[model samples]
Target: MTAAVRSTQQVFNLPDLGEGLTEAEIVAWRVAVGDVVEVDQPVVEVETAKAVVDVPCPYAGRVVALHGSPGELRPVGQPLITVAPLDDGADDAGRAGAGGADDPGGEPAGHAVYREEERAGSGNVLVGYGTGHGPAGRRRRRVGAARAGTGRRAAADDTAASTAALPEGHPTGTGAPVPTGAPAVVGDASAYRSRLDGELDAPLVISPLVRRLARERGIDLSAIRGSGPGGMIRRADLDARTGGPAGDGRGAGLAAVPDLRPAATAAATDAGADAGADEIVIPLRGVRKTIADKLSRSRREIPEVTIWVDVDATGLLATRAAINAAQPDRPVSLLALLARICVAGLRRYPQLNARVDGERGEIVQSGRIHLGIAAQTERGLLVPVLADVQRMDTGALSAALAETTAQARAGTLPPARLTGGTFTLNNYGVFGVDGSTPIINHPEAALLGIGRIVDKPWVVDGALAVRKVAEISLTFDHRVCDGGVAGGFLRFVADCVESPAVLIANV
Candidate 1:
């Protein structure tokens, strides 16, 4: 018996790609099955809630199958690649995460066999299996009223531990303040809320956010829930319940309310009756779909810890103004300026530019910096990268950024325009935010959030003076970096922003 040329198949699934360590959105495919692939080669591009990233191959073999079709939903641990072993033997189709062993779909392919130790550009080293356990822990849910004075709900993470350090310049969760004064019985809507109570096991299930929208519009989900599988609530479920097909439920309040003139028709008030037609109801496809996928993953995996720091951004603001005044013909926003600062800062503190290779069980430090810039669009958040940012001068980076964003906004951004970002920068500043503890893009150590820059009271030269300042927040993976390194990286970034001249690193 010629020992049946034992050839094994290696599989790679979508690895969680963010500090939130969440799911990924399949953005594009670089290769097809039946094609030969090398280990550490770019296989696909995925978008986290923050940036678009290229996931490289961990196996070197002939591509046998692909788990996710373009625009399809691929959960983490679901095989993404099937590679044939090198030998001619027919029995080698198994063996994935046991580091070079052959077992049929028994483990994740975090790193392909052969070159198992830490290697640059390897896809995220996932665990042998998916850890789909229930939510970890929760102190009683924070009520809406109790969440007063919250800095930003979208920015505050529920997982931030109390140990992370904060010195003022960074963004931290200032959870909505405790409700004060009277604890009055406020009654206005949904009886179902009290009916179901805590453990929601309704056959007709809908997220709280979705249910709130339905209640506000006077639309009932009970009828719609009946149409779905096991009474699951879908967007289309509610849509078809009404007379209009594909119509929005926003202004249906008036239609649903009964008329007092005819006692038979008297019902609830229509809060959004006849709202403008410009109002858009997004179907939550593509970019928005990407957001949902990533956010879900972040919440599922990883223990998150957040810290805040407040810095004197005057020097950085002055430098930005001076640079813009000097280079009037370029595309230089605070983001473009911040990217340069980050590139320089990473040179001083490489920890922020690194990622955790879990499957292969290694820590990686990247020498090059690829920056992802989060762009707000009609669809949702899309992160297009400014590749090799370290090599580009400030002016070159600014122009490239200008062109890339114009293309992104126009929906003309080519598929290539969205790939290969190693790190990300989300500028919430444009939205009037002072600071936020953003989730780091997966495989990348950290993500920097740029808050709105405004004049604020600052202690300058032993006196409180008005100074232009902005909040710079960094959310890093706790598994890969310690507070000392993360805080040091933040300090370096704050240094650059406080005085842009500091970015002139003697590279």
Candidate 2:
């Protein structure tokens, strides 16, 4: 027999996308198996809760396997792709057979093999995950000639363990028995570890908090199938299974609440048994899911108070008109003026431009305003930050805002642009709403809501006059300050809107 060829592979794990994000959804694959990729070459495009990012592979080699499919949410630190070295004389057929055609569910067999001199890497970092230019300190573990036989045996063991873990006669969601000698497709590596360690009863959970919650509620994790990437259970999945709000066990007592709606009861009774047919379920993922989670957390945690005032915006409108007329070629937007006003207000009342660090038991204030401007896009509501707005004038702010807004709408903003917001300014007036008790963006202390400016009767100089009027509302976290500070901030903003001279005097 000819000498056996030993092939080794390196696996790249998904790096943290920053801002404490735990996972990202695979939007598309730029490269497929058997394709050659250079170091730092983007192999996949992933959409995190904040932005769409192109994840580049660190290793320069031929791709042997892709870990997850498109639209699948992959947790950070999980294997993203597998790359085999070019010098390995494995043909395309051999490379394809690495996972074993008979073992269809088996993961590609190979440990991360780096060179003795140095580990191969791009040196170009993406977010927090990338290879570094450093000498390899550890010796490489080479698989012996028995690598193929060992992999096959491991696959058989994994398959048997998976089958034994399930209840008898239960379908494995595929409507067929798992093939022998094939490893089970799991949510993450932890599942494989659990099986190999003979801890089949142990649930695969990445979060300690989730485990604690399950323990507290006495909910069996093994019985529930995870809806997260690779069948890994998330907190949301637990909430759904327990029929309770996440973190809070209040949903446990939901049955104690009386259902007083007779009309709804009657409707349900009429549609009985077929009621499920009329229901349309939309799976929340990516940006939309992020929005829901943040908003819910904000509402639950923040003791928010909304204060509103109707301002005569005639002077503000006139000021904007004059500025645009003077320089028609470089016009400013009304939003820019409002942003300038917001900056001024925050400068005066710095308490509103801060976040509450609950863990530290301190109120963290910022010296510069990283203003978040809420813009509605086809993707969802995205707040792109304008860093250090205190340093930019109205014209500069306007130019930056326009460009950033365009990028946000086009879904081209990077993860950096979507975070580190110290304050937020929401121009909901574009949606024709007069006023709203908008939920504060979490971690940020306050949000300024601007409503539609329309012609309304105003008492100017104690006389009835038709003037452009608008409703301005401030929703602030009560943990930061009482109503006095909140009211002062709102009143100052209204003053700026009613009379541009007030804002100009401060500037």
Best by TM-score: 2
The window of 10 residues in a row where model 1 has the poorest summed lDDT is: 180-189
Query: Candidate 1 lDDT, tens digit per residue, 1-507?
Result: 123432345677776543543566564455543334566555665544444445666677655666775446576667777776544233222433232312222222332222222223344332111222211111112112111122111112212221121112222224323222101111111222222122133334323333444665557765454443334464445445543324544475556542222111111111233222344343454455656776666655545566666777778667777878887776376667778888877888787777777788887888888888878763455677777889998788888888777656544453445656677888887666798877655556678887877888998879999987777788877877789987888888887777666677634
- lDDT value, candidate 2, whole model: 0.70
Residue 478 error, candidate 1, Å: 1.0
Residue 215 C-alpha lDDT in model 1: 62
* lDDT of each candidate versus the true structure: 0.54, 0.70
Per-model TM-score, in order, reads 0.46, 0.61
Q: Could you tell me the lDDT of residue 308 within candidate 1?
A: 64
Question: How many collisions between residues are there in candidate 1?
Answer: 31
The sequence of per-residue lDDT tens digits that candidate 2 reaches over residues 1-507 is 013433367789998677778999976565545445667766776778887656777787666678897668899999999877666645333544564533333334442222222237945646223343221101111111111423322444444444444433334422356543222323333333334434544555544345545665567998878775345566567667755443345564664553333322322332332233455344688887888998999999889999999999999999999999999988999999999999999999999999998889999999999999999875678899999999999999999999899777756676678889999999998877799999999989999999999999999888999999999999999999999999999999999988889999998
